[model samples]
Target: RVMYTITKWIEHKLGLKVNATKTHITRPNKLKYLGFGFYYDTKDKKYCARPHASSIQRFKRKLKQLTIRKNTMALNERIRQLNQVIRGWINYYSICNMKTHMMNIDKHLRTRLRVIIWKQWKVPSKR
Candidate 1:
């Protein structure tokens, strides 16, 4: 009932159409806006938005692509490209709370870089 009334009010007063299919009444934490979702920050005692898991996964995918061993790109060039992507992404999502996510991505990225370096070295010496 409330949803219908609100939708009607928007259509009538706001002079706009509300698509029923797209409208969903849900908790803030359940909704994701621009790759970010609300999370409760215990330290601040309030809700804060953070990059969603899907968003982080997408970022990791990019890192994986850049760090792929068979790419044959020079190490310096690959590092530069990786830095460019990381900088832009960080700046855009800087406002969101994502310390833990960053840490996890760091670990995964380090492992990928190690694999890349190993491949670049071409051969390993038995110690």
Candidate 2:
């Protein structure tokens, strides 16, 4: 069978002698999943007898980097929420101080008005 011959060829190229106990003949999950001899070329659209091991390693490394990036993004979002709460508290304190100062001025103005009216009408000061 062509498949058997190809498998034998692959084992020979890899310097791995075929052992019946170790080898298992299985159907391809998909045409691409079959690990046979194949060479791929990006420039000329060619697929030859040998495949590149570098492609497999590169894919694994890229997946690792993506997982790290996702964790960092989640941490940054949590820090952003904490900073927003701190800023809200700061703004609330500033407004409260301003309101207290305004109330003190309002009380002083009312006391001065009462004093002036009492002097004009010859009425005794209440306090």
On residues 57-119, what C-alpha lDDT tens digit does candidate 2 reach at each position? 443354334334224344345446435653553354342223343355346534544554444
lDDT of 1 by residue, 32-84 (tens): 88988897778988989898888888998999899988899988999999999
Q: Against the correct fold, how does model 1 do in TM-score?
A: 0.87
Clashing residue pairs in candidate 2 (N, C-alpha, C atoms within 3 angstroms): 38-49, 38-50, 39-48
The superposed Cα distance between candidate 1 and the true structure at residue 23, in angstroms, equals 1.4
State the C-alpha lDDT per candidate.
0.88, 0.44
C-alpha RMSD for every candidate: 2.5, 28.6
Over 4 Å off, model 2: 1-97, 123-127
| lDDT for position 108 in model 1 | 86
TM-score of 2: 0.21
